[model samples]
Target: MWVYFLLVIAILAWGAHLAWRWKQARDFAPQLLALRQQEGELPPSVSQKEFTDLYLRAEGPRAGTYVYACAAFMTVTLAPVSSLFNSVWTAIWQATGSDPVFEVGTFIHTFSFFLAVMGLTILILAIAMRRYYALMPPNLRQVIRHLKDAHS
Candidate 1:
């Protein structure tokens, strides 16, 4: 009963977290678009909907620190699962009259560090405007180009 209660609480917490992130992204969209306009980063002929859509997609309200923290937490949480699986596999092999499959080392900390670094790198690359814009559909891309031409 207690376990089920805890599970429900955890699910609710996760949902709330997602809602917060979504709201943050939505609310910051206007400001982000405005900043892009001020910096002459936005296309002059773009509509509000188009500008907001691109800005929201490129950058959310959360700071870089929040991204890093989430990455670190994910790495730490999953690290033990890898070790547990390896240990279980080694036990099964030994029971089958075979030698240990591989030597197990305490690499969780190092592994987590490496994972966090890689995760942050990927996140940064994904949020870059150039990469994001490049991946947009042709129609949207054409619209952006028109906006740029109008501004120039």
Candidate 2:
């Protein structure tokens, strides 16, 4: 029960981390775009096509970080939990014999669910951030573009 609770907490933390990164990227983007507009190169309100292109370039890498961070966190947090709680889990497994193939299925199901849950969470965050971007003022958005271009 404790191990399961810990796992749940870690999962929630992973979601929070994803949300945080999405907020970071979403906030930074408009700032960068606005900076660009002020410099008179990029426009504030980008066309959908332009926004798509920019999002593809910038959001792609940023999103990867969120995914990897969550993965790393899970790996680290679960390793100790799994190691310490193994005897308990093993006893329960042996006593119940819940399913002959549960040994394999447990691993598959746990990993799959973990990945799927985190992936979906991050995807939703990205979508939300994208929608927010569309509503941002154009000039501010341009500033973000300029700042990004300057950095690169």
Candidate 3:
């Protein structure tokens, strides 16, 4: 019961955090545009599409931090989420007074295990890529970027 309560609290906290971030981003957009205009990074009277493209170009690379945070959070929360799901399913089963065709706990455990594995894999890949990029020579990196642009 305490675990269930804690899980609910954690979920609500995460949702609130996400909402706060979304609001922050929303508030920052116009400011970012204005700043870019002042810095001559963007022309005055830019269209929405042009602003979007510029914003993505400027901010997209930094998204890896968010991805890594999410992956780590997912990996950390695996046990709690699995426990919550199994508890909920067990309560429902007891209320129903009927045997389930398959063991819900087993499925929940397996699903959570796979989710953790995926999260770990993402974290590992991100770390490896970051290290590889950091170690690469600047000239080589620039060449790779040019090749990527040509392909695009």
Candidate 4:
């Protein structure tokens, strides 16, 4: 069905995006470490928490974009997944003479429904976090600007 096709495409696109992000992170790691160790910046022996804080500050408002994107993706794909699972359940019911109490299709449908609820929750949380971040002070803007300059 068209839903299945769309689901496949969405999955493939997500996989490609993840692969690209992984490649970018792999390439950027050395530069990020070098930037961290530079004079007047974080020391070579910086603690993990300190480094993470610096990185998050450097990312500024854009840090939440990844979470927003993932939540949106889940929101968009949940319906198709649920539909597919429902179709599977129907097919299995038809193939089997009767619907068993502990059928795989029923389990899959329940799991997919649970995932859909979780995805909706995550989407709502992402939206709330985005609004909260938007209202936060602009102190991190300076860190983001400094990191851009250093990268350039």
Candidate 3 lDDT, tens digit per residue, 17-119? 7666655655565676677558755556555554444444343333444544565566467678667767766777677784664356467546765675686
Q: In candidate 4, which residue pairs clash? A: none
**Candidate 2 global Cα RMSD:** 11.3
Query: In model 3, where do residues sit more than 4 Å from their true spots?
Result: 48-152
Give a tens-digit lDDT track for model 4, residues 71-98: 5566577677677767776777668775
Checking candidate 3 for backbone clashes, the offending pairs are: none
**What does each candidate score in C-alpha RMSD?**
8.8, 11.3, 10.6, 10.2
Candidate 3: residue 11 Cα off by (Å): 1.1
Tens-digit lDDT string for candidate 1 (1-120)? 576456556655665676687678777766755766788777545567766565554554434334544544544444474566566756765677764333344365346545655775
Q: Which candidate should be chosen as best, given lDDT against the real structure?
A: 4
Model 2, which residues run further than 4 Å from truth? Answer: 44-53, 60-152
Query: Which candidate, 3 or 4, has the higher lDDT?
Result: 4
- Give the local distance difference test score of model 4: 0.59
For each of the candidates, give the backbone clash count.
0, 21, 0, 0
Q: Model 2: which ten-residue window has the lowest total lDDT? A: 135-144
True-structure RMSD for candidate 3 = 10.6
lDDT on C-alpha atoms for all candidate structures: 0.57, 0.57, 0.57, 0.59
Output the lDDT of residue 86, model 3: 70
